[model samples]
Each structure stands twice: as structure tokens, then as C-alpha cells.
Target: MTEIRWLEAFVAVAEELHFGRAALRLHTSQSPLSQTIRKLENDLGTRLFERNTRSVALTSAGHALLPRAYRVLQDMRLAREAALAEVEGVRGKILIGFSGAVNHLTLPPLTRAVRRRHPDIELDLTSRVRTRDGLASVANGTLDLAFVGVAESPDPSVVARLVAREEIGAVLPLDHPLAREKSIPLQSLAGDDFISPPTDGSSSMTEVLLASCMAAGFRPRIVQELSDPYMVLTFVAAGVGVTLMSSGISSIIPSGATYVPLDAPHHYMNHAIAWSADNDSAVLKAVLDVVEEVFPPVAS
Candidate 1:
């Protein structure tokens, strides 16, 4: 079979339309360039060019092959560039799993930082509330990392880094009587209808709120359960019922909903970055750097 060199020579001669010019462009002698073209034609079992005393012209086969050869060369160049980019940490995809609530405050800054620093990296951000599923996705190599809220310790197989502590608060309609108070006592809402996340949603904030209410000597009369924090907030704004949410969610508070800080001991929800202990992803590291920059821990 003819080598790539033969294709190059044939392409050059067919483009230049002169053996001498093609030889000069290839930095070789006319005799060798002509030989290469002849060799390519023989390999393909077809004539690619016709030569006259004064000028050279492409045969029908050469005309058909020219565009295909150019496309092949372009594709090869792009493939090489993509491989080089991956090696240089300038390209590739990273999957990030996060909670719906975190998207209200954390994702905007994180996304901007990633775009500003590593524009070539593709970020596939997914909002999921199941901590076990999120952790398993990272552990089994489906996700690069996850931003999760955990009341207890993380799985031993996963590496966890504390990102930020978001204070838990009560979300009430602005026109509600409780909105006038600077802080709402959890016990006061005992008899009122409460909106909460689904038990199966694995929301740490919901667990914290439920526990806080219990500690304060009353069980919340949960009127409805939802999965999406924004939807929960929307329901509260529409005067369906009130719910507990992270202070970070205040950033996206509905027009008619007011966020009041909890008093005394009910302060914050622990949020963290979790990934598989086996993962050594540069992209994930880049994401963590941004998170640290945006929400650095206060020293004691």
C-alpha cells in the first residue's frame, strides 16, 4: 500500500497542477514527487492525474479524492489537538452532583469561577437530593464530585471536605404575622400547617428542622411534602404553608416569602464537598479550589 507520503505528494501535485511546483512545495525533487504520485495511483488501481507537455491536470479520480483527503487531514489535526488539550488539563468533561438548594447560592459563583479559570473544561451539573445515590455515583466513577449536606459522617470510602455552613431559617409569606418578627420560635408554629421536603428526599435541613421542633416541645403539622426547594419556597409565597430552609436559599427567596433567622441554638447546616477516595481528578480539584476561595472557613 502507498504511504501517507504518497497521498501528500498526490494531493500537492493535484493542487499545484505542476510537478515542479509540487516538488518545491514538498521540499523534494520533481522526479521523486512524480514517482510518489505514480505509486499512489498504482495503489488505488486508478490514474489520478494526466500530464501534458505544458501543464498537468487532475483525472476524475483525483478530483473526487481531493475533498476527501482534505477532510481526512482536517479530522486528524482536530483529533491530535483534542488529545493534547486533554493532556494539558485544558479540556475534558466533569460531572458534578449537588442539591437543589445549593444551586440558589453556591452554583453561580462556582460556575463563574470555573468559566473564568478553565474555560475548556465541560461541566455537567446535576441537582440531586438523594445522598446515598449521589455518593454512590461518585464512588462508582459516574460522577467526578458532589456538593452534599450530611448531618452524620460521610461514608468511609469517600473523601469529604467541609465547604460552608449555611444557617437554617423559616420561610414564611411576607404578609404572614410571623414575618414581622426578627426571629421565629420553632415551638410557636406547632399548630400551624407546615410544608416540608419528602421524607425520602434525604434533606438534612428537613431532619434538622424536625428535630429542632421536637426539641422545642411540638411536632410540626406538615401540610405537604416536596422535593424541590424552589417549589417549596414558591408554595410558601403563595401562602400554602411555611417551611425550613438553608439561609443560602435567601438569595432566591420568592417575592412574597420572607426568611427569618432562627434564634439561639438553631444556626447552620453543614455543607461539604464529597468525592470518591479513589478519584484523583484535576477538574474536581479545580472546582474545590473555587469553593474554598468563595467560602473559606473562619479560624477559631
Candidate 2:
């Protein structure tokens, strides 16, 4: 039964504690503002302010109503924003995924950029996803965008754009013999146990590692498989085995581990931004625009 304007007038007077100042703050005449506050007190059956010619102060009832009235105004503003966001589509929900290796390199910057520019958009980010699963998620609408590392073409229903590249390197313990080399040869690691890449079958790093090893006349013996670069490097540092990683994660190399470049015929990891061709969300379009601006597509 209470009107919003009455509450607004009450709150302004309650805060300023002066009818004339509160009227100026509300851009209304002091008498009308005072009348509105008096009406609000009558409706509530309690005095909301204690006043004299010198100054004004809050009554016990006024103190209680102040916070409640402010909250009502806040809720109304939020509700209005929610309606506007739904209509514009810029504030709609978006799911973004990334494999672990590229999450460190790309997700951080991309997440920051999107949040800064489109603060209303809901962003959901998942890390350590397999390239195959991430691509599948995009096609099915479970994901709006995915940062994947690929060695071959993705599904026909999706578009893959090369956004970044990193030369593959051997991740080895500092104490390992190969770690001291200026540039380690792929074949030299053929005998060591390896932390294989994601088994998702779409990992270009795994393909390159196996193919490079085969070209050296031997295949790597997989001792373990890890989806996270940091985890994979942890095992390497523990002497569990040596593994291949992209130079992009070199900064995250843990203590007792280091990254050494691969010699001639060096393998590289191609990081691509992939999304379904079926996606028509305006929020998705805005994200793609930012993606292209941050990491422009590389010429094929």
C-alpha cells in the first residue's frame, strides 16, 4: 500500500536530516518533501525523524526504516537492470572453456577483457578440458567457445581460427642429462619414460610427439598421461618421467624442472579459437569480436 515516492522522500530526509537540504537533494520544494515524509510516518504509524529549528535527527523508528527503505530502492534498480540485460542480450549467459595449457596463456587475458568491456555478461570458464570434448561441447551448445590445440581440421559444423602458436619443448628435471643440452633432440628422449598428452585423441601435441619419435626410429613409452601442463611438469620434476610441453608454459616451470627447446624439425603447438557455426547468440558475437581483436586470426 506504500508508494515508492513516499519512501524516497523519507530516505532523503532521513539521510540529510534537514527538510530544506533533503528537498534540494530530491529536487523538490521543502514543504512538499516534508509533507511526503509526514504522510509516510502516518502510513507506518511511527515518527521517522526528530527535528527542531536548529537541526534534525533520526527517531528510533527512523533508524530502523532507513536501511529497509534503501534496500527497497536497490532491489528495484537491480530488477530494472535485469530486465534491460535480458532485452539487450549482451548480459546473457556465456560458457567459455579452455584446455589447461592454453588456459594460462589465453583465458586470463580474455576473461579480463570481456569482464572489463561487457560487465553484465555471465561468463563461465572451465579449464583442463580435452580438445575433442571441448569441440564437441561447442557443437552441442553446452559451450559457447573453446580454446583448443589441434593438429587437424575440427568438425565441419565449427569454425577454427588460429590465434596463437608455441614451439614444443621437452620438459625435464634440472638434474636430467638432457636438461643441460643447448637444444635437446627428440630422438635422444626416445628411451625415457614420457608423460603423454591428453588421450582425447585430438591433442596435436600428442600427435607431434608420437610422430616425431617415430621419425627418430623409436616410439615413446608412455608412463603417464596428464591433462594439465603444471601437473605434467610436476611429475617431470619428481623424476617420474620426461614430457613434451609448449613454450608458452615455460614460465610456470616448477622448481627442479626446466624447459629446453627441441632441435631442428621442432614441433609446435597450434592454439585455435573454435565455436559452432550454429551459434547465433548476440553475446557470442560480441565475444568473438573481442577474441579477434585480442588475438587476430593467423593466416593459414
* Highest lDDT scorer: 2
1-300 per-residue lDDT for model 1 (tens digits): 247677678778876899999999889999988888887888899999888899799989989988667555434444554675666855656778887865556666777888888897788887854565676666655567777665343457787677677777889988888897989777777777888877664676677778778887888989898877788899999999988888888878879998888787775677776776655555666766777787777321
User: Each candidate: what lDDT?
Assistant: 0.74, 0.79
Evaluate model 1: give its lDDT.
0.74
List residue ranges in candidate 2 displaced over 4 A: 1-89, 151-154, 200-202
Looking at model 2, report the run of 10 residues with the lowest lDDT sum.
73-82
Candidates' TM-scores? 0.66, 0.69
List per-candidate RMSD values in Å. Answer: 17.8, 16.7
